[model samples]
Target: MLDRSESALRVVVRSKFYRSAFLALLIAGIGLSAATPQLTLFLVRDLGTPLPVAGLYYVTNLAAPVAGFLVGRWSDRSHDRLLWFRVCAVIGSVGWLAMAAAQTVWLPFVISTVALSLAGGSMAQLFAACRDELSRHPTKAENRVIATIRMAFTVGWILGPVLGSWFGGVFGLRALLVATAACVFAQMLPLGGQRVERYEDPGISPLPEGRRRLDHMMPLLVFTAICVLAMTGDTIKFGYLPIYMAEQLHVSDSVRGAVIGIQPLLELLMLPAVARLADRYGPLRIMTVGAALGLAGNIAYATSSSVGGLFLGQALTAGLWACVGALGVSIAQQLYPEGVGTASGIFLSSIPLGSAIGGAIGGIGVAIIGLPHVFFVPAGLTTLALVAFVVLTARLSVRMKA
Candidate 1:
């Protein structure tokens, strides 16, 4: 039994589908993370925009994920996933092209909103494609594949800020925007061969002859919604943390960079362990713990008076974030035995949706109530999310027993 179990583990570790998924995630993380941190800096420092105005600029970005969700659902009904994905990438490139030409914040902001929305659409399509691939090889459990994806994203983030800082020093922010667009387009490269059967829900009911398996997928949708709310709190740190550090505590750029850099590296290192825990303890438990961590981390940030306090708080939050992020998708995948394409689109788009919400809220808080309060909002939200997560898990557990 021990030898058989060890062999099964080895097969999972060496699977090609998981390997490709990890690579796609890695490329995504490195590219987006490298470019995004510097966007506000570009607006404020380079374009001579005020912080409040920059905040508003971020507010407009929330529309992208909504559009992505809609487009993804539509695609599930009728559309070529790869073709639409490529088109969205092209649109994302155009957004960058416009940003490169901007002399004012409005121009870049307008383009970024559209471009980001398109990028969201592209990501939705990409995930649906990945889901299709995973389903083909679904004989094995998928928890590790999900963790591998999150780790890739963290790895990208590790690269993102370093690259942003470097480009900000060399070619200026506009050039960096152009470079980001180029990378998004480059992500369009052929991933090579599709293996899984595309999932299509029969209808909405399993009773009727041609009816769909609605009950099987409903739990997944509920979980996805819960994840969306939890993620909203999780995303605040990235979009606003550096600015918070700089403004509230008078942190130097170098220190801010270190704090930001530390997050992804920590995530990259800890994800495998978190993945193991998700498998052993359960994804639900892992996610609940993550939400609690978010609550604590945000509260620490809100009350902290020192730089070390901030970093430590952020690090704690990152560990929890990794746990939830790694497990959430796996849970969602398990929920949808059919309609992997639709489910992947819905599940993946939640992150961008949450980020959009967090960014808008964080931007507003920074502009009005102040930086310290930014953490407070996320803390409150995360606390609420923890309650929701607990309730959801409890219900799921009950269902499993019944």
Candidate 2:
């Protein structure tokens, strides 16, 4: 019995589909994280855009969900998701190159917006691919696989910023952009004609003719929206916290970088345990706890008057994100297994959408009230999201019992 179990375990551990999906996601994460920290800085410092205007640049993210939804729907219908994946990588590479060569503010704005949007769409496709891969191997824990992918991403983030800072500091932001483009293109080499098998469950029949699919999907959709609202707090912090540290706290660039890097590093420590809890308790429950932690973190930020307090708040914030970031995709994949691509797209799009709206609002709030006071806005948003989510789960439970 032990030998048979061990043999089965080896087969799962050595699965090509699982290994390939994780590798692709890890590389993509490296490319994205390496460039992300420098983007707003490049615009504000190099291109002479104000913080508020730079914040407005994220407004372009409003259009990304549409792009994601379309690409995801198309990926669901397409035979070769790998083909679409390669195309997206190419598009993202070109966008990075355009950003590298951009002389004017509008050019970078347009390129960043379009490139990141395409990248977001690509990510949706990738999640669908991963889910398809996961479907083929039933013995593997689905949430665990998802958490492992997120760990890959967190690992990339841990390395990317340090690399970006070193590269950008030494060779300039253009060189950094070029390197990022290379990283994006490098993700393509690993594919090597590997195709994701489409998912089809034999036991589950199609929905009846009169039942609207949208009706069945509404609860999850509402849940996604609430999650987005909660995410806006993190977005606000990402958009403005570095600036706050630099301008308000008068920290040096190196210190600022360390402060920014610490969150993901701490997150790396938390993910493995969080993944286990998610597997045991369900993703939503873990997410709820994370949301509460996020609220506390935001409040800490609002009250913080020193660098130590800021760091403390950021640590809590990292804990919050580590939970949601891993589980959000898992929940979305579970909720809409039939259209994993579309569901994942919607889930993926929420990040940027939340960031765009939050950054815009944060920028305006900073301009009006002051940087220190802006933290309260996100706290309020998170509170509302948590309330809505609790109500939603309660209603769902009542219905289930009935």
Candidate 3:
């Protein structure tokens, strides 16, 4: 044990990079997260949009990450991570403002696709910057450092939903959107004029000849594919859990809310431990374990008819996200080792991409299999992906050992 808590952690605690990056992530998380829990409701109930039209809102989720990936790639080339971060936040704020003032039916779609999606790339830039900052001090535990920063965002998500719900109810959805915009703009304050260097490891060993580029990219793509599948399961749970509780389990509002909130809260608690585990057993093995647990968790939700079962299932799935969300970026950065910005962008984009898939899958699966068991759809798909990952990694490992 390196007593990293006293040494590296203290360094993180005292550094300006940690303070600014942590607070920016925290603020941005709250801003974006606060708006999400009520998006469908705002679209349908307040805006008078039809259910079918409202369902199309998830198109924004798919669109944002594509723009984010591009912004990240640009940052690597432009070497202006800080500039994009601030610019994206400003544009995202304008998007929220547009959303608040939206009188036309089609305005939200345009703003989200054109403006806010660019803002979605902001977090990647910040994380890329954080990676650069970490490069300055090799003594720091990289996994733990990144994990610690992510936990701030996790914490914000934990609190944001509650506040958003209350604030929206009391002050109206428009006011809530305005407040969220303010929060988005505030992300720039903590990071104003802050230096954000681009960094990649020069120590990465070259791959075997002829297959260098593709082979080098395999691990990054593999892990990202895993995240995509995992988030699909998560997206299913998130969209359906409340509906499931009301229609099937017949649970009260408080109980349903508790179950909805439990996983992220659990993720906050699990991050440090998973970080330590990555320090020991490595991230990919841990990610595999997480996938296994997520598979089991989804199965639990599919089979059960009771509230307790949902709780148990949610608690189990926390392991997967905790491992993936924290370690996934580092794994991508390490595997790429040429561009942290692009690596992080592609990896972070998995959530939205999987979300786009999850929306379609959840709709079709529910139509066919119905409630509770609809979960098995994502569970089964994830199983297939997991098997592929295992086979590919095993072959890759054998090739390396040879």
Candidate 4:
């Protein structure tokens, strides 16, 4: 088995196309990840926005991905992946500029939200292009490639927050935004004058005589909804976890920083193993495991008093999140074959929306019930999502067979 896998890796790495695309994705991760948690924390801690309000700020930004979805869908029909990616980069850069220049909270909110939405929204389109270009495999191999692409973003997440914290702490939030914009520019350099091949829109269905019908894609709409629901449980940890750590565990700001830094690193570290698992067991099995781990971790968090307890819970949560983040994109790739760009946009948007909802719930729970309750709600929600994931995926497997 090891020999077979090594042989496969050798074949793939030898391809110039895969290497170039992977390099592009690696650079892209550095830029896109830079602003994520830092911006939210800045708004809450420095800008004096309350937790719930800060959450709403993020929720507003989620609309940008929705726009990306619409734009990507249109691009799909036109078969223009490169055009969409470029447009998204331009819009995202402007958003970062807005973040850097805004005098008031609302101004940054507007700019950052739009910028994040567009930039993030276009990622699916980019992956779709990459996937189409690398369509050289059986189903399992293709799924592994998709999983690896998503894992690349986990690497971005690992770096983004650490850099954001170091830069934001040392210089300022504005400087961090500018740096992120610069990264975006650098990442875009490789794609210059390259025409991206767009895949068949996954949103489209198979019709009579082997033609795909749009109506058959409706099941995927629900699958996307499930993705959104599961992700909310995730976002809560990102947007509100720092505050909770500061207040509940009474950890120092630096310790809080360490905790934040730890999550993405753990996630990135785990992806290769998770990717192998997804290939062997299928995405549904991996997702169910992720959801269950998240549920248990969050529930344990509710009872945690010591810092060690929090760390244990967080480690489990982060590991599970890594699996979902990688495999979710793979599933999305399968579901939205034709409209990959648009579908990717739609799929990516769910994370922020989930974050928004989770943040809102956490904020309210912290304020009224206490921090432990905040942990409890997400745990419960994750458990429900796990059950749903199991049922849905089991049904999806059946549908595929039929």
User: In order, what lDDT does every prediction score?
Assistant: 0.67, 0.75, 0.80, 0.68
Q: What are the clashing pairs of model 1?
A: 29-156, 30-156, 33-160, 34-160, 203-212
The TM-score-based order of candidates, best leading, equals 3, 2, 4, 1
Candidate maximizing lDDT: 3
Total residue pair clashes for candidate 1: 5
With candidate 2 superimposed using the best TM-score fit, by how many Å does residue 251's alpha carbon deviate from the native?
Answer: 5.0
TM-score, prediction 1: 0.82
Deviating ranges (above 4 Å) for candidate 2: 1-13, 44-52, 204-211, 246-255, 395-402
Q: Choose 3 or 4, whichever is better by TM-score.
A: 3
Clashing pairs in 3: none
Off by over 4 Å in 3: 1-8, 200-218, 392-402
Whole-structure CA lDDT of model 3: 0.80
Task: Judge candidate 3 at residue 269 and give its lDDT.
Answer: 95
Tens-digit per-residue lDDT, 1-402, candidate 3: 344444445656888878888899899888878988788888887789998898888867777557866787688776566877887889889989989999877888888788877888788888888777877666437788888889989999998988898999999998999999999999989866877666545675533345775676667777677678777987788888799999878889999989988999998999988877776666666777778888889999999888888888988899988987778888777667666776788788888888878988998888998998899998987797677657655655433211
Per-model C-alpha RMSD: 4.2, 3.6, 3.1, 3.8
Which of the two candidates, 1 or 3, achieves a greater lDDT against the reference?
Answer: 3
Model 1: per-residue Cα lDDT over 243-278, one tens digit each: 677876788988987887776677777787777676
Query: Least lDDT summed over 10 consecutive residues: which range in candidate 2?
Result: 1-10
Q: 1-402, model 2: which lDDT tens digit per residue?
A: 112122322443587755666666778778778888798888877788787677677788887877777777777677776666777788988999888887777887787667768767776777778777767665335555666666767888778877888999999988898899988888766666788866766754443234566776566578778887887877777767888888889988888777777888888788766766766666677777888878888888888878788788888888788887777876776766666777788788888888878877787788887777899998898898878867775666433211
> What TM-score would each prediction reach against the true structure?
0.82, 0.88, 0.92, 0.86
Can you list the residue pairs that collide in candidate 2? none
Judging by TM-score against the true structure, name the best candidate: 3
